[model samples]
Target chain A: MQSIGIDDILDMESRKRAAFINCLSGAKATNLIGTQDKQGRTNLSIMSSAFHVGATPPLMGLIIRPDPVPRHTLHNILETGYYTLNHVNQDILSAAHQTSARYDKDESEFGATGLTSQFVANIPAPFVAESAIKLGLKLVHHQELAVNKTHLVIGEIQTVLLPEDAVADDGHLAITEHGSVAVTGLDTYHELQPIARFKYAKVGQPVELLGE
Target chain B: MQSIGIDDILDMESRKRAAFINCLSGAKATNLIGTQDKQGRTNLSIMSSAFHVGATPPLMGLIIRPDPVPRHTLHNILETGYYTLNHVNQDILSAAHQTSARYDKDESEFGATGLTSQFVANIPAPFVAESAIKLGLKLVHHQELAVNKTHLVIGEIQTVLLPEDAVADDGHLAITEHGSVAVTGLDTYHELQPIARFKYAKVGQPVELLGE
Candidate 1:
């Protein structure tokens, strides 16, 4: 086994350190966050930091780095109070990744990446038309972390759109079945293969695999 | 496409809703968060919410559900200010998932699940001995969400331990190469297969896949 202390980690080159630290937590869900600026220009950016926050209210949270310069996604979400999270499937990986580039606030990533943006049922934000699973979220909370300048943005799920067959009878949406990709670090993509699904665990009993 | 509205989602049964909402976000990194209570009782619990928070200072955050009952993992981290996040590989997936079972405070998950507890440099918390990658973290900041009762616990990486072969020359860790598992919903586990790695994106330039 090899070990690295804090001092060693702090000394690595910035980009290398970023890659190391980002991949350390392992594979993350890849999504393109779509928000519309106050002037109604759409902005789409690749985000792997989004995580499920709760279930009852159907909340999700994503982390945004410090605003040294203007962050169009954060600005748009704040201005409109609504955004969409669109899962990045294999077909759109490159376009989704390209959205991370520092484009001007006036530039729309939808046009830049060649990904179609579609507005649904009067939602102010646009969803990536290529996404297999799309979520409409209304901003509910935002907190700036004092440790780092990153902000945690929480949103309540208002709508879900997906292919009917993607959802199972038990309510699990098989993501890989729809070709969605998981990401590691900043640029590596992974294909997911379901290994096993177990029933809810119980003390003093061995877990029963769902199909078994 | 089928669409589900907020009212429809809120009307579903709790467990089904949890499963549906959890899997909707896609694959998540699976980890065992290890902490020790003040009385020296070690607690290990499976967590899928861990996400990379930042890189310069090297921070990671995980969500802890509302503690209506005593959450041993949350209690221990709050009491001691230190915890370990250990990656769950295929070798230890069953044991790792078993840690989710409700066990008595005095009964260590390590003993119950047959996973070894390892202490490195007296970090106060234990790491899963079978894990190929482990991190020792010091709690830096914690915030309670008003929308949901969940708490976002942030930690700074103090020490990192990994197998020498797992890290690339450029600092990206090939987690799938280490057999770590990605999880979805409550009980589904997935094996990861690296698809592609691209260089950092730049506006107006096509991303160059690494090694292409």
Candidate 2:
């Protein structure tokens, strides 16, 4: 086995270190966060930091990087108090990745990347038209981390849009069935293949596979 | 497309709602968080909320549900200020999932699940012996979310252990090559298949595939 201590990790080049540490955690959810500023300029950026926060209220949390410069996505979300999370499918991988490039506050990533933005359910924010599964979220909480300058933005789900056949009778949505993809580090995309689905685990019992 | 509004979502049964909402966000990184209490009782729990917080200072955050009952994992981390994050691979999926079952505080998940506990560099916390990649972390910051009763525990990377062949020359670790898996919703695990790897994106330029 190989080991990397703190000192050795610190000695690596910045980009190399970033790649090493970022990919170390494992596969991440890939989505395009769409927000519209008060002036109505739409902002779309690729985000892999979004994670499930809770279920009762349907909350999701996203980590926004430290603000050394102005962050258009964060700014727009704060201004409008709403944003859309659009799954990044294989067909839109390149365009979604391109949204990460730094663009002026006035520039819209939708136009820059050739991705269409469509409003849904009368939500002020725009959802990525290319996304098969889209979510409308209303900001409920935001906190700046003391350890890092990044902010944890939490949102409550207000609407869900998906194909009728995407969801199963038991309420599980087969994400891979819709062609959604996963990401590792900053640039690598992976196709998801469901290995197994187990029933709710119980103590002193053998695990049961779903649909068996 | 079928749409689910907030009213319909709120009306579903709790377990079904949990399954639906949890899986809606997308694929998540699956890991086993290992911790030891002051009494030296070790705890292992499957966690999908682990996400990269930052790269420079090398921080990661795990979202732990509120402790209505004693949470061995949270209690141990708070008591010792150290824990280990071990990747969940295909070989350990069943055992890894079993850790989620409610176990008595005195009973170690390691012993019950048949997973070996190995300590390295005297970290005081145990790592899953069968895991291909493991990390030792020190608690840096923790905060309670007001929206949900969950807590976000942030940790700094202190030590990293992986197989010698796990990392590529360019610092990219092909997690899939290590047989690490991803999870969605609550109980579904997916095998990862690499689609494409691209260089960092720049505005107005075509994305170049890695090694091209």
Candidate 3:
């Protein structure tokens, strides 16, 4: 076993520490955020920090890093107050990962990566035509973390587009069935193999495992 | 293909909507957050909302639901200012999921679920003895999501314990090598199948694929 303390983490090189600490929280969902500046030029960037905020109003939260790195996606989301989240499946994994490259503001990632961007229902943001599952959200909450200045942006789900068959009768979205992959650290992608699904958990009672 | 709008989502039953919308953000890391009240009674709860906040100071964030749900984990963190996040692996998957059950205030989930509680380095919280990877963090930043009152708790990593061999030479942690799994929606846990790791993405340069 290995034991590392705070001093050990802080003493390491920046990128190495980033990689070490990044994987500590475990696997994260990889999504390509689609946004467009006020002038309408589009931007696409990949993020692994998206998390469920709540369900009643269907809110999702994303953490955007502060300056020094590219801020196009965060910029466009704040500029337009709307953005799209497109799941990065095997079909577009490489292209989706390429969206993280630092591109000039004048260039659109769609054109750079050869991925098509489709405008749907007048959402003012583009959706990855190759993505299996897509989400259209309106920025409903934004606040900066005092600890790091990274932005915690929460959005309300306005639209969700996915294959009808992928949605089970009980409303469980069969994401892995549609090729959606999970990400770890900063750049590794993994395929998800279904284990079993359990029914709503209750105290002292065994949870009934269900099939996908 | 299915297209769900906000109105459609709001019209569905609460639990169904929860299942539907929870999958939108993609798979999340399932972790056992261990904390203890001021009186030293330990509490352990399963959480899927943990996300990487940043790496410079080594911060991780967890979104805790407001009142209605059991918040013993959140309450203990607030009360003691320290908590431990232990990765959920196959060995403890069922026991980990079982921790979500509503337990008596005096009953520790660790005892009820048969998971061992091991206190390390005077952190004021217990670490899951069975977790392959564990972290001790101090509460650093916290705020409520004005949208739904769900609290966003950020903690700084103070200590880390893991198997030495799971770390790659380039600093990426090979989590799947340690039996860690990812979770979708609420109760579905999936095994991670190694796909490939990509080098740091760069504009116009073809990213190099690295093997685990």
Candidate 4:
């Protein structure tokens, strides 16, 4: 094994360092966060930082990097207090990646990337029509970490839209059945091949492998 | 499409709700977080909430769920101010999953799970010898989120250990080549099959797919 210290990472060039550090998080959840401005212009942006915050209240969290430019997703979420998280599947991942491109506030990524904006009667935020699993969330907490000035935005899951058969009797969503993809580092995307699902861990019991 | 609202989710059985809500994070970075007590008794716990906090300072964050029982990993990290994040690979994933089993404070999960513990001169925490990618980090920030009482621990990467041949010219680690796996929901593990690596998004530019 090759060992590298913090000094070595600090001495590396910025872009190289970004790639190196980004890979440390391993495979990330790739989602397109959907939102819309007060004037009803929609916004869609790619987010890999979304993670499970709490399951009881169904809280979800996304890490918003310190931005030098305007972030329409963040802006719209602030303006409307609502947003959507749509899974990026194999078919639409390229268009989903394009949502990361910066665009004018008036130019929606949906139009620019050729993805469709989907809306329901109750939620103002748009969900990606191509997404197999869609979640509508309401902003619940926003905080700027005093340590790094980056933002942590948390939302409560208010609505979920998916194919009825996608969920199992035990409540596990067969996400890979719908072709939802996973990400490695900043640019690489990968489809998931089920390995195994183990039974819940118990101290002295024999482990069991639950099929995918 | 089936549309389920918050009321439906709230009305779910506790076990069902846990599984259902856990899938919202999509695929996660499956890691075994290693830490040790002041007395040097080791601990290893499976965590899927590990996410990149920043690359500039090489910061990483892990969501520590609100525990109904004592959390040895959190206790040791707070005690020693250092921990290691070890990527769970295919060969040792079953053992990695076994680390989640509850054991007494003095008994090391490494010994219990049959995974070997490795040590370095400067760090107190143990690293899983079976893990191909290992990162030693120092706790930089710890906060109990006011909204859900869940704890968030942010650490600065201090040491990284990996195979030299695994890194690319662009600094991305070929983790899948080394058999590192990703997770969906809580217990399901998936091996990554590369689809494509796209270039940085640019407005109005043709998208390019770079093969893995």
Query: What docking grade does candidate 1 earn?
Result: high
- Model 2 ranges off by over 4 Å: none
Q: Candidate 2: fnat, from 0 to 1?
A: 0.73
Candidate 4 wrongly placed segments (more than 4 Å): none
lDDT of 1: 0.90
lDDT of 3 by residue, A71-147 (tens): 99888999999999999999888888888888999999999999999888859999999998999999998988789
- CA shift at A101, candidate 2, in angstroms? 1.6
Interface RMSD of 3: 1.1
Better of 1 and 3 by DockQ: 1
Question: In model 3, how large is the Cα lDDT of residue B179?
Answer: 87
Native contact share for candidate 1: 0.77
| Alpha-carbon TM-score of each model against the true structure | 0.98, 0.97, 0.97, 0.98
Better of 1 and 2 by TM-score: 1
For residues B1-212, could you state the per-residue lDDT of candidate 4 as single tens digits? 99989999999998888898999879999999999998878899999999998988899999998778899988899999999999999999888888788778888888888999999658789998989999999999999998899999999999999988777878899788878899988788999999899998899997788652
Our model 2 lands, by Cα RMSD against the true structure, at 1.3
- CAPRI band of model 4? high
Backbone clashes in candidate 3 total: 0
Ignoring the other chain, what TM-score does chain B have in each prediction?
0.97, 0.96, 0.96, 0.97
Root-mean-square deviation of every model:
1.1, 1.3, 1.5, 1.4
